[model samples]
Target: MANPEQRPIGDVSVPLNTGDVRGFKKEMGRLLEDPLGGAERLDQFLGLNIYTWVELPSILGILFTMEERDMIRHSGMRVWDRDSQGPDQGDQKWPMQDPGWNNQNERHRQNMSDLQWMIIRGIREAVPKGQNLGKAVSEHQGKDEALEDWLE
Candidate 1:
């Protein structure tokens, strides 16, 4: 994998665009809205490319809201530290760690660790099987990389 800092979040072996933050966020929302529907398109977008590098800071930006930015920062730190003992250890990684916030013409990614964790915690608490989806998404979508990705 590319150096963590230089790793373009867009190349995580998943389909995405390495571009600006805003459009990438919007596209991510759309993809998450219907991953299956977006899967084909995303796959095509990525083409034959493999081994995508993540952009930690940008990932946090798109995934988090202003109110939760600090929390995301903390989560990112935990990710970098390889501490499975992260604050919200059991929460999902994708949409937080390896978020697919990309567009066709973008060249970057963001980490929304805090907001995603909150959503994961909230959803799980609110619904009996909600937690399952979070884990499932991360695993199926290939966001489950080593914690070291965040550290570099």
Candidate 2:
């Protein structure tokens, strides 16, 4: 069996090595490009983390909610308007109104949305029937703590 500490990247499971950041990046890029196959790999990845690190599901859920709020805030603003009376005195466009900045923000929002959907899909597929990622992890932790208490 593979070591519990090793994380799967693509077809192989390996221990995380900060020195091989470039290699990890390359694999992630490849995974992102192939959605169908990537989903399966992502499921495995999330499953491993869900079981191995009890806090991960809650952390990811919080981060995902934060990203959704940020996206909503960005989308709610009218990005094409000028704030002429502001600090630039009409010499410079408002940062949010700048074409480049708006485009970049839109791209970032889209990327984050895609990533969030991918993670949600992966979790739905990876988790067993009648249980979500968060519930499963919480239940697992509860069982462990209960067992410990009983033992003590």
Candidate 3:
């Protein structure tokens, strides 16, 4: 009979981008100073850094994969347009024309909500039953080394 000790821990795979993620954890040490101030700092940090990572191409269904492919797939332009002029479809040069500002703002709000829901769903899916997703740094993690349940 096979020993339970040799069994695999989980079906979920470690995210490919975790190395990039672990780099951001350095700010955590500073968060211990004053939580409110830390939160503000974290907000700034995430504003500058986190979105680009979280909003990966795959996450947004941009490119299908990192593997080489010549053609690209897209559902046409996302911005609303009248005739040929798209909302926020102005060149960045000095002669900037009025982009459909109303439509742009509406799209922005819709996108914000979509992003929030997507993140929440991703979090829910990552953590299966009986798994603690997060805990305090001082929590009593045990010494089980095989599957590392003790680290929880």
In model 2, the runs with Cα more than 4 Å from the true position are: 1-23, 30-32, 51-152
Those runs of model 1 whose alpha carbons end farther than 4 Å from true positions after fitting are 1-19, 30-63, 83-152
**What range of 10 consecutive residues in model 3 has the weakest lDDT sum?**
68-77
lDDT of 1 by residue, 79-148 (tens): 5445444543433433335546443324332233333333333322322332345555565323675657
Best by lDDT: 1
Instruction: Report the number of backbone clashes for model 2.
Output: 0
Best-to-worst order by TM-score is 1, 3, 2
TM-score attained by model 1: 0.24
Error of 1 at 8 (Å): 23
Local distance difference test, candidate 3: 0.32
The lDDT, on a scale of 0 to 1, for candidate 2 is: 0.35
What are the per-model numbers of colliding residue pairs? 17, 0, 0
Per-residue lDDT of model 2, residues 114-140, tens digit only: 333434444333323443445445554
- List model 3 lDDT by residue over 39-113, tens digit each: 344344334222322343333233122221111111111111122242342122101232222212545434333
Candidates' lDDT values, in order?
A: 0.41, 0.35, 0.32
User: What does the lDDT read for residue 103 in candidate 1?
Assistant: 33
